[model samples]
Target: MASVRFNLRLVAQSHWRSVHRWQPKRWLWGRARCCMSSLVGRRVMLTRPASQAQGMAANLAALQAVPILLPVIEIAPLADTSELDNALFALAAYDWLILTSVNGVGAVWDRLAELKVPGLPPALKVAAIGPKTAHGLEQRGIQPDFVPSEYVAEAIYPGLGNVNGKQILLARADIARPALLRLIEQGGGRAVDIAAYRTLPAQADPTGLAELRRGVDVIAFTSPSTVHNFVRLCNGEQLRFPDLPGKPVFAVIGPITAQALADYGVKPDLVAVEYTAEGLVAALLNYFESQPLRNSL
Candidate 1:
């Protein structure tokens, strides 16, 4: 049975090689390695707002995936900024300014410039829900006092210290969830939730829609709003997802976005370990590399 044992050893070696063709360490390489990637030539559909898709698109492109920009949501400034203005005018009265997204930071700063507000109050603490949001604040020479390890709304409360008897200004999207507001209120803080920007359903780009109709390999959702807007746009346009051949893989940036997909009787094939564009791309690479092993088994 020595020959039989030798044959099994060879078979195992071959399987191992196939499974680990692409190593996670190689993903750190700055240059494109598309020639050796399973994601090479794969068409990835981006469903975030057009303004936000560029970075993610560039990441995918660097990895040699064809990024089809099918922005399902648009971020627009509120038509009536009266309340936003009122909040900004009295910024010194608030104890904390909570920003959840890059879009929120942009909206707030744009209004701040309009109001000729030089900067935030010296005593006013700032909190960001994620590193990306924190980076946005940093770009404007403002450093956040609190940034949660977990990038979700629920995670922000714990890092916010004692909010008891404090006034917190939450600048967020028009359709933002009430979880953060509820959390602050439960902790005895008065939270003013303002619509910093409007997340509206975008008219799908014709070129991108055409590319999608031809068939894409994967679709990525960054937020719940993207998922919701994607469904709304698809249904409103009479495009039946069930009819699409060889259903594309659904990928989400986080659990919340995945949950949004699940609400519509859909499940994500990949969820990013980190809720960021780079994390999503890394997850996709890891996923595609394991396909051979999955198929072999």
Candidate 2:
């Protein structure tokens, strides 16, 4: 009986060694499979009619291993359309158009379509803060002339290089932070700010939050509001494995969101080097690679 047990243990050890040898390729395959699985039966919620939720869905699909649970915090129209309309008109006059978020792009695009603004100015150079925002612009047939290597405003600020005397239009949410605008102004550029949309706090979805707490391995936060609202919704609830601070990683898009997590007393385990969904996905994958056994369990 002792000899038989020893033989079984040796076989198991050999099998594990083989698996370890193939770990790198297996990890890559696992990520690919996850991405494909995420897209199989997914439906994108299109809050803004003109919003490129489909494109966003495709982008999400490509990052399947990241485990993003998008419990939309809130979706609302631009509180004021007049200012957006004026901003679109001003777009034609400005030398540059800056888009800070996907929502900002959608709001501005919807307003432009409504007002029948001829076409984006031919000479207007477009700048986007991240790849997703840049993708939003591309879907509208406009290519961004400037996108930062990093997704944060601080990273993007220096890349603006020299915009002295440049007329720039920044289309963004009503409650968006003023970092971008402030940077543009500091660069000697005259910036006209327009509030394209407004984000209202969404009623906490208890059922959804419950499922997330129970099943999700990672939580991806795109903005500070999402983090704040999500935490508020989960207030009083205990996490599945609270003892492990990094068990279910909190992945943030950029420093702003990382700060938001910090403010809520939750430090993110991973933050994307770039502020786009793809970047977020890559960061998550890298984290998994570094901690394969933790992910497997």
Candidate 3:
């Protein structure tokens, strides 16, 4: 009986060890750890009172229960339509069409539809920097042939493989980073760039800004302009949730936006592993999962 009991204990210990090896922590615990870790070495600059900070956890809980409401912040035209038009005309002659943003896809499609340009070249293939742009293409009755698993300029560029002597047309925002275009040129591809759209800061909506100030559990900034506009609208007003510096989660889609947050003295709670809306959403979900204690409390 004693020997059997000892063996049973050993088996139980081994089982637990194997379980830990396979799943380091349960889902809830994992989230809590992530949230805690992200905050450990960060600084908090609360413009609000201590009571408001503590109330943030409760506000977050309530916000999580509600549906995500997205507000349109801005819409504007590209700086140079002539350049865009010329680029689209070149599209039918190029070997590849590379879209870096959903805005790019929309701009090109809208322009082409307006011009009634007929038929893309048979040799031309489309590539999107990320899933959002790919989905934008799908909505226009087109499909992207390539989308990288990781949605960053660096990641997407390498996945293009060799493009030596290939003609590639890149459509993007007026303020787009030059990394992808530089990479294409370096890879021996003849790259033509066109500014598809421009983004302007949205008019300040006082009511909406007040609601945002009241308490936002998670603030998502999709672009640098959004970050700039959001900050401009809010100014230096004290937020309802003060603990946010330590806990309130801020998510950004790309490095440029992430840097913008830092420049504004707003620490991001989560940075998307990739540069796309899909990746942003995934990163948010992952962040929520990591803060089990905060979520459960």
| Local accuracy of candidate 1 as per-residue lDDT tens digits, 1-297 | 323321233354344334332333245345365347667778889998777889778878877778989998888889999999999999999998999998999999999999999878777878877666876886887767677656788888987789999999999999999998999999999999999999988888999888777777888999999888888877776777634433678999999999998998888899998777777888998888866411110
How well does candidate 1 match the true structure in TM-score terms? 0.86
Clashing pairs in 1: none
Higher-ranked by lDDT: 2 or 3? 2
Lowest lDDT block of 10, candidate 2: 41-50
Pairs of colliding residues, candidate 3 = 31-289, 31-290, 31-291, 32-290, 32-292
Best-matching candidate per TM-score = 1
Find the 10 residues in a row with the least total lDDT in model 3. Answer: 40-49
* Backbone clash tally (model 1): 0
Q: Which lDDT values do the candidates have, in the order given?
A: 0.80, 0.62, 0.59
Q: Answer with 2 or 3, whichever has the higher TM-score.
A: 2
Ranking by lDDT: 1, 2, 3
Query: Which ten contiguous residues of candidate 1 have the minimum total lDDT?
Result: 1-10
Tell me how candidate 3 scores on lDDT: 0.59
Question: Which is superior by TM-score, 1 or 2?
Answer: 1
Error of 2 at 84 (Å): 1.2
